[model samples]
Target: MITRIFPSVRRLHRRWFYGLMAMVMAVGIGLATPKPSQAGLLDLIFNGIQYIQLSNLSTQDEVRLGRRIDAQLKRQGVRIYNRDPQIVAYVDQIGQRLAAASARPDLPYTFQVVQDDSINAFATMGGFVYIHTGLMEEAANEAELAGVLAHEIGHIGGRHAVNQMRQIALAQGVAGALGVDQSALVNIGVQLALSLPNSRADEYDADQRGFRTMGQARYAQSGLVSFMRKLDERSGARPEFLSTHPDPGNRVENLEAMLESEGNPNATDGLNNSAYQSKISSL
Candidate 1:
């Protein structure tokens, strides 16, 4: 009677263990590469958790993350320029054109001006992109302004922020991520918005994407190349642009190569300085 009862207990334990593993797999957590020592069900549940792949994150999750980051940026004193309807409308128009030409044309892209005088622009997750007033003031023409917007949009299209956050979460040891950590998400967003620069590869990829978008949108393909050359010429002690983007020299080189591949076409068919200037004069 004792032996028969022991066999029944062992069978119960086996069934319960397999059921737990099946549940873990169903939840998409057990797909991770298991550790050699983590053969047992309990160890699999508790040990050596790995990073969640970016593919696991949905587009809605990305938009939510962007909204959180955008909120944090607003709270951190990042001013939004809304006083000039003309400026806002014009920027939005150009941004829409670029987005239409982008790979992810259906994304709800938003382009806004920041009141800062720094020559920098950044894109968080989703389709949010910001350009500083100083960068606008320095742009030679409408094409140049559109070029910057296209570049920022490229960052969004590439989902750079989401990729960055995945790495950030992994580094922070937050395993089994399902995108519900509000505090950690906010902190990561702040870091991305205020301090972290995208990798050089990311910067180059964005540049290429922007270049293609500008070409397809009938804007001057060389506009970004010219902008990078100007930045390289006048790069003094760390400028805001350099702080968040790749070096001007490398960017210029890459853009020049791209331009060479696609020979010069007619320049941008967009607004002239007078049109853009009159609109921005309100600032």
Candidate 2:
């Protein structure tokens, strides 16, 4: 009986191995040969594995993935502030203004307020931006808050998160093979959005892009620079913004130069500090 059981087990293992090899070969061939529909053989395998490169993710794919990541973030205990509808609406209003003036305005943008008190803001792919309640309170005026939101939108416009995902996949030796599984990619995205510091080049690009967006939206250009200056002057531990977004050595100076180059360094659109504070008094 024992001998018979051992032979059957060996046969079962052999069958499983051959089956896996066949599936892998089929995936390779399907990838090599283009299909008419974007969703083809690749979509059928492994519960809908996306075979495309991360950098080339379509707008729909990016948005879908972002939704998944956002859901997971909520599940992981990142609370969304919903106690006050007005606060969320106000933030969304400012974010929408900046996003409309952004380079990629066609993407559906969703701005959420995080309940946390940390002075940090971040953007994931597919036009999802989150601003902390603390960050809102920290801002002296509406433009300062808008500056942070615009910076986050700039990240989405630049597709910095997608680029970072591709680089991480390559470094992990999975990109060259079957590409990352969708679930794994989503996990990676969550980690990147939460803890990773963006590359120095990406930070500078975001700042420049955000500056332009802010100006285009007619928000006072000084808001961004002033906010950064205020953060830079803070003592004690670095703020989450400074920690997550590495200071590009001279971020404040560069932003000031951009304002100077625009030849209107004194634009005062969103600089009413008293009104701004009154609006956010509930928080």
Candidate 3:
């Protein structure tokens, strides 16, 4: 064993020791090398990728979006206002009543009844709402009109339209989206700033809010039920509004059930029916 332990053995041991040292250095270098982190990595792939600007839109932006769309819609075509001054007054009267009870009554809300025989109605952004003459004719009375108007009021007061703008701006980004030119992005924003397309959750919320307003203003909730029933019964000549706001099947049912618990209270009408008839007749 002593003879075997030669200087050559020492040389081999030194070589093996150096090999082990080299292996340790390799492992240390591999451990120290940095790997990619999980955060702020998306920016590398998407150029300035942005998201919904719900909280980003200013009040001015909201109002501007509303006004822009209002103009575009008017340019597309101004709806025929019933010729009868009384009809205009009647709609304004009920609208004011409902607006006063709305969450954002300070907004300059205007309600107009268009001389069209379609069971339809819609609320534009920026506190403008339109009701079809057909819808008014279909309504049993002023309370029903008020109920319908109240629902629209709920939509506006909920800021659903402005919220829509935020959604579009977010999805579209502060830059551009949906193949729209940068110049037309604002236009698309305005057009998309609708009230109803605001999610089923928003619709349900608006429905409840409007119902409460109807109750508070002493408008007959059964008017809402009757109106919904009419909408549900509608078979022919559906309006564009119908295309957007599908019949909330259980909406009226739920409203009736709610009223049942609240004892079906009395309603005081602020409508000028005689004037409405005269105005509509002229149109």
Number of the top-ranking candidate, with lDDT as the measure: 2
Scanning candidate 3 in windows of ten residues, the lowest lDDT window is 175-184
Clashing pairs in 2: none
Better of 1 and 2 by TM-score: 2
Instruction: Write model 3 residue lDDT over 101-140, tens digit each, in one string.
Output: 7887777776777767766777766688888887777666
Best by TM-score: 2
lDDT of 1 by residue, 1-283 (tens): 4545588899999999999999988767644654465455446346642223454767776776677778889988999988788888888898999899998897878788999888888888878899888888888778888888989888888888777887887788764434335557667867886789989988998999999999888988777888778888884566588788867798899899989887447546554778767667777
TM-score of 2: 0.82
Give me the displacement of residue 142 in model 3, in angstroms: 0.8
TM, every model: 0.78, 0.82, 0.68
Question: Can you write out model 2's per-residue Cα lDDT over 43-70, one digit (the tens) per residue?
Answer: 5574655655686689998999999999
**CA RMSD (A), model 2:** 12.8
In model 3, the runs with Cα more than 4 Å from the true position are 1-61, 174-186, 193-198, 236-239, 263-283
Q: Give all candidates' CA lDDT scores.
A: 0.79, 0.87, 0.67
